[model samples]
Each structure stands twice: as C-alpha cells, then as structure tokens.
Target: MPTSRFEVLGAGAFPMLVHGALILLLTGSIIGSLRKIPADAYGRFAADVVAWGKAKRLVFVVFAGLGLYVAVMPVIGYTSSTFLFLITLLVTLAPKTRTALVVALVLALVFSFGLNWLFAEVFNVFLPRGN
Candidate 1:
C-alpha cells in the first residue's frame, strides 16, 4: 500500500514492459550460452583492438571534425558550423569529381542554411545566430 501517486504506474508504461523484457532477454541469453564455445580467447580478445589499421587517418580526421563542429557551433552559429561539417564529410566521402563537388556544395547549403530558414519561417523557431 503506497501513498505516493507515482508509486502506481498506470497503463503499459515503459519501465513495466521494457525492464521485464530486458531481464528476460538477458536471463535467456545467459542460460542458453552457458555451455557454448567462445569465438575469441578471453585474454587475446582485445589484442588486435588497439591497432588503428589502414583507416586511422580518416577516422582521426572525422573525429576531429566532429569535435570542431561542436566547438564552433556556438561561436559561428549552427548553420555555418553544420555547413562546414557537412561539406567536409561530403567532400571526403564522395568520389573526386566536379559533379561531386557541386553536389556536395549544394547539399551542404541546402541542409544547413535552407533548414535554418525552414525552421525560422515555418516552425517559428529561432536558432543561435552566433556570438
């Protein structure tokens, strides 16, 4: 007998269903895999994980780009920051060609500034206009 109103979870709430489902799933998995053979040896599972492999430079650049985007967003506004980020990603990932460049530029502009305009006009929402 609980006195609090929130103590009674009404209807099919998330915690009521999700938590039980997760518990059942984990318990079933644990029971089923009790005698199963392991794929990788326990100690060497992380041995090859440290190596960055061939795509190290690309991975690092993308990570840095994301960090820079977040850092510059407040200072340069969301539109400009997103434009730079999108342009960089599009240029780096797409094939090297004039058509690719034009498409990247157009997409970057459309997604960044165009979306900004849409939000401002249609949704009546204002974004940070830089510092």
Candidate 2:
C-alpha cells in the first residue's frame, strides 16, 4: 500500500523522541542526586573523579574500538563482531584470564543471540546477518 520506502514522521520518530526525553530525565536525576550528596563526601568523590579522568586513556581506546566494531559488524556478522568486541574488552582491561574468558564467552553469546532476538522479535527490526 505504501509507495515510498519511508513516510514523513512515521513510527521511528516516537522512539527517538522517547529516548531523547529519557536521556534528559536521567541526566537531570543524576545531577540532582549529585548535588544533594553531603559536602563531606566531596573529598573522596572528587579524588575518585580525578583518578578516573586520569585513567581515561584506555577508556577512550575501548570506545574507539566499539565504534570500529559497529562499523565492521555489518560485514563480519554479529557473532564474529560480538566475539571480537568481548575479547578485545577483556584483553585490554587485563582481567584474570579464567574469568575473562568465561565472561567474554557469556557476553558474546548474550550480545549475539539476545540482541538479535530483541531486534528481530521485539522491535521487528531485522539486523543484518553478514555471514
């Protein structure tokens, strides 16, 4: 019945608006809570924040890798991408090998199957199976 691939102001906009509003609400809530915390907590909390900021290099790298994974996932397939993402995260974070491997395997399975299921079944969006 539809002619064009997309119709102006269709179903997609609602999700986008909802997500945006949720983000705004969450940001407000976090800011409000942080402000309400006692001033006595500031010394330790500020030190932790500074330490975290100083330790952000690896964090940035991981985020960059996530961007790369998203870019490549369409070509490599969800399972492969998920495995790479999980393994990369585990290795870079220097987790204990036994726990890292277990966590990586579990994460890969969850991401590949669970996310795929969510997209295909819950959202009715078909994510590409590059393989």
Candidate 3:
C-alpha cells in the first residue's frame, strides 16, 4: 500500500528532505563546474586530485571515525562514544608533544561532557544511554 503524504513527512522527514536538497545542490554545482572546465585542464585536475588524496589522508580517517562514532553511539551511550571520538581525533590531529596531548585531552573531555551536560541539564534534552 502507498503511504499518505502526512506519513511521509512525519518524524525524521525534515532532516532527510534537507539532506536530499543539499545533495542535489552539490551535485548540480559539481556538474556545472566540470562542464565549464576545458579539456586541456583535465590533466591538471587529475594531478590536483592525486596530490589532494596523498596530502589529505587524515581527512578521510576523520570522516571514517565520525561514521564509526555515530554507529557506536547507540551501543556505548552518547557521552562515551563522543568522548572517544573527540579524544582520538584530537590526538591524531594535534602535535606530538606532552603539552599538546594534555591540551587535546582537556578539550575532548570538555566538549564531550560539557555538551552532554548542557543538553541534558539546560535544554532538558537527553541523549541515548546504553544498557
């Protein structure tokens, strides 16, 4: 049976709709830009892409870690998952020094727990808690 319009727009529909629209806009922009690029520029674009891939490996790692964080949040609880994600990301990105490590740790703790506390205490919104 086909669902009604009301059912389609209920609950998580708004975010999904926004995401879809943003994706469409991004695709259109990319296609438009690529169409305007001259054939002679293809080699340069390819070289640029390769250089970016080599230099920005950490960017891919951070995105993968974020995906993992979202997947594990429901199982490990929001605070623990967020703390792990932030701390790991900070340590990965920060300089390899004792002071930097300490600063990253403090920032991770503050962001994870502070946000959690703010949401739960101030906003009266609760995140998922694992058993």
What C-alpha RMSD separates each model from the true structure? Answer: 4.8, 10.2, 6.7
1-131: candidate 2 lDDT, tens digit per residue = 23345666666677889999999999999999989999888779879888887788787888898999899889988767877787778667766688877877787778878888899999998877886
Q: What is the Å distance of residue 72 in model 1 from its true position?
A: 5.0
By lDDT, who's the top model here? 3
Cα lDDT tens digits for candidate 3, 79-128: 89999999999999999999999999999888888889999999999987
TM-score of 3: 0.62
lDDT of each: 0.86, 0.81, 0.90
Off by over 4 Å in 1: 5-21, 47-75
Candidate 2 runs further than 4 Å off: 1-55
Q: Return the TM-score for each candidate structure.
A: 0.58, 0.48, 0.62
The candidate, 1 or 3, that scores higher on TM-score is 3
